[model samples]
Target: MTLLSDQMPCRYVPILAIRPAEMKALEELPEVDKDSMLPLILIRPWLSANTLSKSINRFKEAYGETRPWLADIDPFYAAALANDDDDDDEADPKKVFSEIEALQDPANGYSNWCAFIEADPRAIPCLRLDPNNINALTQEIITFSAMQRGICLRIPRAGFGGIGQIADILNAQNVTSVLFILDFEQATMNELSNAAAAIGLINTIKGKIPGAEIAISATTFPDSFNGLKEQAIAERGFFSLIKAQLGQFRLIYSDRGSARAEKRTGGGGLPPPRVDYPSFKNWYFFKPEKIPTYQAAAKAAMTHKSWEPKMKIWGTQMIERTAKGDPYAIVSPVRSTATRINLHLHHQLYFDDPPLALQEIEDDWVD
Candidate 1:
């Protein structure tokens, strides 16, 4: 199910976000039907505004005629779940709710509702999760609500866009959208090959989800190494293996440098001599598009899900990489020449012994 296997190239070109009547075009898509779909129903859990039945009815009415994607797609709303002041701007409590209201028209039926029931009873999920719960669900009525609607779930972040938590949330909230994250192409030092391979792995994850978009740029950085290489042969070897095994891939260099670098020069305490590792600026993506092999690699990405995808990596740094996969900067005298490679591997561990109960998404919403 990679984006492009000889048999699995994606027919879907770009990812689209719809609201209200904008969904009309989706209705005509053959994939809308349950029988034709690999998976039916597109969950817009992020749409928390239309929580009230009246608003939801309007939301449905807005897109009632044209959209087939969410025919019965019910969103997961957590008004009781308060957010922190530092939360993403797009995720502002009031904005999330108001947008839902904007979609309301009072014509169609509610998308279905789920009241949050917490374990502590008094410590309701909404009360703890959403800061604007009162303002959002202020007039929510109890009696007319239906259990068939849902239990309004919470998807905890995992540093990397909350992968796999979507399904977990659905199970908790009794909803159906299997939203999850599949990170592909998180740039590593001297790991272009592995980055490419990671994209393939991501494609594989996406292939499993009918309407999923890959969760991209979740952990990407500002290219801390500035296109630096590694000194360890073992690390490069591992990257090779990763590249070979990747199912789908897309990458953007990031700056998650919690690691330090030192030179073995005359000045032991001082920073090492200048190294000339190639840079792969992601400012202008799509070199992969020009190369048939790279294009194939992109198509080979076995993506099964989709998240807000982007190129957090810059576009100017990368030059024609060597066969060995080292990114060479396209510049005179190599900006940081004679630079010996030292790679610091960053890992995303789900279980790291001490036991973790909470997760947080780190990136800011672009819009």
Candidate 2:
């Protein structure tokens, strides 16, 4: 049954990693169980560490007191929990054996947990017919491990006095997932201090969120395009060097671009003078030619199911040409199996201004 309307905007970005807990949460919803079902059980093939970590947290919170049986919650969680309680960081041989034995016990009910597992995230399931798993990241794939204990990290705009706090949150014994929002508002291109700060922040957070991937969202860059570019290059370098990192990176620009005084065409019956230098381009808005390399770099920061990687770049759709007939810095995704599927689904959903058949979601999971 389609509990969520196809017409409804998905609360989360479907392209990014979906946590098993998020999926499990859907199954446990009141709508799914008319008969007061105990914890819902799902049987599936593969569960990514990202999915398992988030699922554990979701169930941990949603089923507080009335803890439902998450047969499929990460097998390691029980051990991790037990280990967290131990004062010494070193593993005790007997303690390890006890946890393993407890899990093996039928009374403990930690075996063959079920959640409807269809697609394997690791397999980089092809979206449709494109034959390439282009949408999957090639680097650290963000998962729930970054936000263990349901902790969320919001870096402050002020001097990062909160770095200690962020470390505290990331170091939480139960922390397995994190929603790391890198606030670059204070970033100034004139000085590398902000850039240095960002590098420091990322280095500190690395590998702190265990098992699951981290979700990175950057607010904005500097005032000048050069500053933005400098910061972007620096950040790209930092993540490239780090072996352990998050699953996804989202760049949300505060403004599209600062207005520029390109000489007006036909102003007072005068043609604009041709300029040698092209207009400025920033990370947020840039030439389409840059999309492939930029997206590739962004995806590089993520871990993917396949080495042959693809990515989806979303921004303002450009169709019209300006009076000068010069094209705007229009950005778009490259062709791939995933892109085809996205286009097919988009056409189906918004083919009409107000779609006629939105009441029922067409299963676009298949081509």
Candidate 3:
């Protein structure tokens, strides 16, 4: 029941927002890409009880197989919602409780996690080691570890100082095998100090929990592309630095699937018409200010050197169709997001491999 091993081709672990567009991207991923990566899906807080109920099923359907993956309710969102005293109907704490109950619950003695297990046994639950939640989380970890499915400890940048305490909790629960996700939400490696600090933390975690699998997760994707045309994929550079120092210590690569690390709040205006293409190191962004339409954006992207017509990727297919005036593929920010993410996933999975050729000949032909 090992989640990852030397024999597997698992290279990327994308931290995805559990939304329709992201789900569509996952659903459309090629089997080869799916085989090469694991997805750590974060359930956003805005979902209602009905949507929450459908999310796990959606995830299972999109994955198309009972493969190992991680699931966690957004801890920041959960904490904020739980502490909110406002009368906002959408931010109701009861709704948050229901959401928690559907995913993982400590209030009701992990009844929710048990039910979640019944729904998708392949899911590897993630726990955020918040001090306030540690007591409950310890019990949850014990329960999950007893199942022998493994547990993911999602440690935010701020949680590094508490590593000793976290190790004690794991030790007390007798949970030796674990997945540590060092999440740097909306943070980047623009500074050398940040990279050094991250490496140090990784070393500390490895020292505490020998042989534990670790993943470095972060995102530099901006919340708004305002007045911006391109952004470097800093997570790649950061991961590269860590890998250089660690050598072959089984550290997994993770990012936000080219989506913003921090969820944006408010703003009802339509998103700018843009299409983003991911290269080996940077994201080539296209936004047609004059035309202000997805068709124009797609057409503009086609002119970029990064756009490859021969690539059989789902995102490129959408862009090509839209550029050629396909109405079905043109319209809405949701479709645009899905297009970008699908491409990002493909690029990350095949970063070191050649592009998957589009099948043009019948395999049944006798030579």
lDDT of each: 0.25, 0.27, 0.73
Better of 1 and 3 by TM-score: 3
**What value does the lDDT take at residue 161 in candidate 2?**
57
In angstroms, give how far residue 319 of model 2 lies from its true place: 5.6
| lDDT string, candidate 1, 137-254, tens digits | 3222121122221122122232234323333323333333222222222334453334554454445444544433332221232233333322322223333354355534432111
Say which prediction, candidate 2 or candidate 3, comes out ahead on lDDT: 3
Residue 71 deviation, candidate 1, in Å? 11
> Pairing residues by index, what is the TM-score of model 3?
0.87
CA lDDT for candidate 1: 0.25
Q: Would you estimate the TM-scores of all the predictions? A: 0.24, 0.27, 0.87
Model 1 residue 97 lDDT score: 52
Order of the predicted models by lDDT, top scorer first: 3, 2, 1
Best by lDDT: 3
Q: Mind giving the per-residue lDDT tens digits that candidate 3 earns over 269-361?
A: 887788887776778878988998889999988998877667766777788889988888857888888888888887776665644434332
Q: Please give, for residues 114-184, the per-residue lDDT of candidate 2 as tens digits.
A: 01112121111110111122122111112223211222333334525555444444354454433343433
Please tell me which predicted candidate would have the highest TM-score against the true structure: 3
What would the TM-score be for candidate 2 when compared with the true structure? Answer: 0.27
